[model samples]
Target: MSGGLVALLDDIATLAKVTASSIDDVAANAVKASSKAVGVVIDDTAVTPQYVSGLSPSRELPIIGKIARGSLINKLFIILPIALLLTWLAPHFLPFLLVVGGAYLCFEGGEKVLEKLGWLPGHHEDHEEAGATSAEELEKSIVSSATRTDLILSAEIMLVSMAGLSNEHGVMRVAVLIGVAFFMTFFVYGLVALLVKADDVGLRLARGALEPEDNRPGPVDNIGRTIVRVMPHVFSVIGVVGTVAMLWVGGHLVIANLAEVGVPVFHHVLEAAEHAVSGAGGFVTWLVETLLSGVFGVILGAVIAWLVVGASALVRRVRARA
Candidate 1:
């Protein structure tokens, strides 16, 4: 009886070790996969803040919260399952889907450029100027728009993550995907919440720091005043950065995808640029690649914008007659 009990105990210890090893593998895989999606993660962060801009001080945090919630749902409930199915059943379709996503990024980046150049018009600036809108109405519009945008970005992120992972068992794939989804939503939206509340935080600090004399400034008040002064510049910088990111990332995606499908032109051009710099070529190489990518992104974006606008007008005309 004692001999039998010893053998059973030894078996249980081996099982425990196996389980621990499996958990470690899952964690390592999750991290690896998540890192691949970093570009889309950056894009997500860049794009989200714009949705909350131009809202009143009190509505800012609440609007961010709503969008954050929607983003979470998009990743977990919607994107994760679809990603798993795509990976499992239609792995071959992944690259094509990524190209479609790349085209979308290019189109969006192009539209922004046109709007900036006064060739196209978007309602975003006008909406910001139309003040005193009800919080509920604003919240609904912002959340809906944010969620729709999130879906595309989330799809890109998921595809990147999927491409990074090994063709593992179904269980492991699902686990890694779920892990990536949760991590991205938490990281992106947490930063957004902080960004949207920054001005309000500054205001509160300024108001609380009452001067001992009516004419004197308190430390908190001074700090708040500084923040208020800087807020406009900060937001302007964010907007500029977001637009640049869209162009760079979208261009990079298209170039990379083209290279993946055996297009040698972009790769060879980048290689030539790298070689031209000789010993200190790394910086030059990076600059060349970025500039080329931005150019491609802008061109692609413009073509897409033209098509979409023409299509929309045609549709409207057809509907009016019908």
Candidate 2:
């Protein structure tokens, strides 16, 4: 009986070790997979703040929290199941899915570009145009809009990450995919919370530096003042970066997946650029690819945008005539 107990104890220890190792591997894979979707994540972070742009300061963080919660629920409940189903039942069709998602990113990014250029009228309904009649309704609209946007970006994040995990063991793939989803939600929203509240934080710090008798500024005071002034520029920079990232990632996805689906024209150009920049090292090659992808994304996106706008105008004209 004693020997049998000892053997069981030894077996338990071995199982424990195996479990620990598997958990570590899952974590490592999750990080790697999450990294694959960094561009989309950046786009998400950049785009999210716009939803709360004109809202009351006190309400911003809560609205962001609601959106974050919605994002997580959508990912865990809806996206995960559909993604798993597709991965299991129709793995071969994922490239087309990527192309669709990619084109969406392009359309969104390109629309913003055209609006900024004043070439397209603003179709996106802002706070006033949304027809929110009260505080509660307005809050709901903001949350709804932000969450809706997050759904697409979140889907891109999961699907793009999944592309890297296709060959992983089924169990491990599920674990890593789930892990990436959770990590990304928290990470992106956390950064957003910090960004939206940064000015408030700066104000608090500036207030603390109010020495009635001695108005001499301390280092913290200077830092606080600087933060207050810098955040606007930061937001502007983030917006531009996010737009470019969407274009580059979208273009890269479309062109890369096109190769997988037998249309390699764009990929061939990208590869040639990489080859040309080979001697300059990995960073240079990546830069060339990104710039080229951004240009391609913008062009493709503009064409799609024109078609969409023309169609909408035609529909409106037909309705008016009727």
Show the lowest summed lDDT stretch of 10 residues, model 1: 123-132
Model 1 TM: 0.80
274 in model 1: Cα distance from truth in Å? Answer: 3.9
Per-model C-alpha lDDT, please?
Answer: 0.76, 0.88
**Residues 1-322, candidate 2, lDDT per residue (tens digit)?**
9999999999999999999999999999999999877778888888788888888899999988999999998788889889889867988899999888888888878988998999889765586545788999988888888888788889999888888886796788999988998899999999999999998889888879876678877778888899999999998888888888889988988998999999999999999999998999999999999999999999988888888999999999999999
**Shift in Å, residue 3, candidate 1:** 8.6
Q: Give the per-residue lDDT of model 1 (tens digit) for 194-215.
A: 7667778888888888876785
TM-score (C-alpha) between model 2 and the true structure: 0.92
In order of appearance, the predictions have TM-scores of 0.80, 0.92
Model 2 residue runs over 4 Å out of place are: 128-131, 214-218
**lDDT value for model 1:** 0.76
